[model samples]
Target: MYHNTKLTGMVVYPNDPEYQQARMNWNPFTNAFPIVFVFAQKIEDVSNAVKWARENKVPIRMRSGRHALAKDFSQTNGGIVIDTSHMRNVTLDKKNGIAKVEAGIRVGQLVRMLAREGILAPFGDSSTVGIGGISTGGGITAIQRTAGLISDNILAVTLVDANGEVLQVNACENSDLFWAIRGGGGGNFGIITSYTFKVRTAPSKVGIFEIIWPWNQLNEVIDAWQRWAPCVDVRLGTILEAFSKANGLLHSQGIFLGPAAELEKLILPLTNTGSPIKVFVDEVTLLEAIDFWAPNEPLFDTQNTTWSSTWVKSSLPEDGIAAIRTFLERASGSESNFFFLNSGGVMNQIPPQETAFFWRNTRYYMEWDASWTDKCETQKSIKLVEQARLQLKPYITGSYVNVPDLNIKDYGQEYYGDNFERLRKVKERYDPENVFNFVQSIPPAHICDEKDIDD
Candidate 1:
């Protein structure tokens, strides 16, 4: 029913030589085959593609860096994929301290680009993740405690709705849509073509530290971290990762906005209690620290094939650190790990109702993940992740939308909390037909009974 001749963008069909390259996602576990992949080079091209999909009654999947953990939301079988990978362009208004970034630009590329101009934007830890996806889903980074979430810096967004109408959303214009897209998660409201963000001056130097403790010291190290990291100087942010017994690694890493001496003094409590095997702390340029936190990966290399089927569940760690230790003890895969991201300071300053991201008061955000190479080990890895989620449920406040898990039964309430109704209303306003939909996407509230909701 769809015709390639009617499409404006570069369309790659199944028979095209570059179809597989265009359709590949970061997660190899995704088996969905798109009917066609449209590489949108301009905003008009995106609008044209959306119009084409609507006229042909085809499901549309919007993709940028293709790093979505829940690939079902970014790819679809027998559906059209409107990929914005070709629309990467970044412009900065140095005088105004604002940057206009295209949707397809990777976070690492943006960081490097911004660094050249002595500017910085808040982003996730992954170098290859698309700014479009992360910023729309409340991007958390090493500097979040100091700088706030990536969404918080967003001044405006240009989106193409289901009707193929291009609308610029900001505080003064299309204000409601602006609020929803800030942290409502991507591919729900519409296809965001570009974002205008309020950027900050990059610090001349930042302190970076890494301390590794043996598995036996997990409890002591984690307890120290929970008590100290979140409440430390707002200029500091930390992450704790507990690798499986197969890897036998428990490490705590952080970046501080000030010099190494200040960071050393503040982190003394963490260093003294854990009996760490190795501890390294030093001051480096902001760019160097960013690279240290998240190293870059080759964008189009499928030969090595690093594939992971991941399930993530998040919560505020109160009494859950012990349960996390138990899960890590029982973890079986070579790459299974439990990650905790320190969340307080500037991140907590934002009230929960301001944006769709509701876990503002959380001290630390925890994630349980499993990764494997062999398909034969898939079941075991997924089961481990599931078991960890079930055990930690009692201690967790809610889950993060960026690290999505299909196993979540009440995804809307769990991800958005009390903000689901407002998000649904926005979805209804922008996409009344529900053309932009996925397994865990917000459904318009009028369609579902309010009594059925348990948030």
Candidate 2:
């Protein structure tokens, strides 16, 4: 491998001792071995690695937590992988309720650091997911209903552009770049090095809920959830996840923030609609609440899975719910989960045009996820996700970027909607050469469409 061994950061080849660990990401399905893995130790190391990859004419795969769903975004067959896991650093400005964190930090790492200071930032679901990817792609957290997404909390960021020069971007300086990073998906603009965010103080009391029902009742529960979940108080947010148990049974679960009594009151509608096998709700510290819903790691051990999702302006109608029910009943062919995530919390408080994330009119975001271990079974799992997507397509108006599955055929249009053009102009002004291109990259206007380009 052509590597600068004398460089400060460690370089690992396929045969290196840490190769397997370095390549192992949250998403185990990505199967690619870069010629060289640059384990960058510092900001300058990240810049140098990027410069090296550019000079070598090598395709680059940058990893921050490596939870990316698309194999193309985090894996390259024979290229350079810039591994940033070692650069985790968190500094809290308690007075300002803000935290400055390194790109390599994970949601759990940052949360723990901030909790020590009685501060909180709206990060994504998993603690292992790197903040760089999460914040850049518009992070949605359990706390989103209260403080907005992690991207919305971004007060400043130091990113390395295509030219390998670091630029400080924020609301005032490099504002366009800042907007793109908030929700435009990462790797399309630049490599984010550090993010300065406006963290919020945690609520004195946080609530938790875990409920499960029979597979047959999914339609009823979903129909009821879609009607009531979003209308819950802004102090509360709900994530309804449908999953299969180890015994080959399907289940539905979620997380909410509020007092247990109040949460139970809000959830009474579902209890009345369906017969649940398990139901538990309680209140706990905002920090302790993290483990209440799921104290253990929640990811399945499978690489080959297909997940597709979209947003809807209104709740699914009876026919829509019926279609989803049909799919859910048939979804036992593989371990699949259909989820509904309510969007209005602090997210709605911000105007749709204020940032690139344009799901304002949509009340909910939905996902059809399927996972399997065998490659041969991949087709079956994919079909389940596709069936769900097709059924919900009529109601889906837009999409979310952080789910890691950016398979929307017309990615730019679906993910960004009306904001696609503005993001493209920012892409030109910042990384004109498309140095940050990837599987779901925002292509320049001249290369894709003329009317979309901004002056």
Candidate 3:
């Protein structure tokens, strides 16, 4: 491959001293080494890197915060890595209630920046996660029930296509690409350089609550939570986590866009289910609540930590509470847990066809995750996740794209549902050669024959 000396960003080869540090990801479970790593400083630098990769016949993997659960999606054995971590510019329009944020900014930075202006954008729970990954995958946060997913608040996007052409996509221009990018998942479409988001006024005071029960009451607490949380006031967003008995606790926590007294009254059903060992509720500013929920963390903080492989599967809980309890009873390690994210309110107000995100009608988004420290326990832990999935298969309809799972066979329907074909068409139009593709990416429509399309 011929190197381009005119490129604006710094490019590092295997021999470079910085190469080792540049290729590392947040998750230590998988190892990815690329032929070249380009630290993009500007939008034009991304374009130049893409053109260089195409000419060299090398695969290109776009990375932002590098927090992807499915590590393989953002890594290639011997390809080019286009990292956008250096482009962290954010411009705000307070009067217009809009913010133009670069792809490299972390969710915590975006949240704090907006908080300074008494405004906010819907973001995920993890502060270290990248905005580019979350927005594209339909981000859900504590205020999601009120404000909707992060993707829903996006006004427009500036993308650099596979051919290295700059494209401005929005409702009025490049509408198909615009529609696909929102909740269509990243790494399938072009690289998003920046996002224009519609911001909302931050509430003066919000309620933050956490309640914990003994493991013996997991079933009762989960049942009460599922019936109450999703049907509560749209202003409240909550999550329930049932940890393994080794952890010895079942907890429910969330944020409410109101005072603590009002939030307590609404969540009484959950708190009253079992003898709660601990209960805490307080009224604080939105920023205070966010910090309490997910504290700010360093970017590359995973080294020397106990590396664990994680598998996640999502579903809409129905009559599966008993199955979930049974699965947890036979779970493998202390790190294993099951989570349910309340998902009604404004999220269900939008029709599924309105965007590529098709799980609007689900009451709650559920995830079953298992982690292990030792290599000997890896397969056993993964098997536990798979077994739990099999038990809940009769009730689950789809999975979340943010928590990608390679174990899924029919990923197209599982992730995109009926919108898969349309996404495929959009992929053909934007990346005809499948330049931006990976294991679970939307394949170009032409590549799938009639038989595969029918399936």
Residue-level lDDT of model 3, residues 231-289, one tens digit each, is 89999889888987778889889888889999989888977788999999999988898
Which pairs clash (backbone N, Cα, C closer than 3 Å) in model 2?
Answer: 108-127
lDDT of 2 by residue, 402-435 (tens): 6655445777777888998888888878877777
lDDT of each: 0.81, 0.73, 0.81
Separate clash counts for every candidate: 0, 1, 0
Model 1 lDDT tens row, 356-400: 877788778777777767677677767667777777666667778
Residue 106 error for model 3, in Å? 0.6
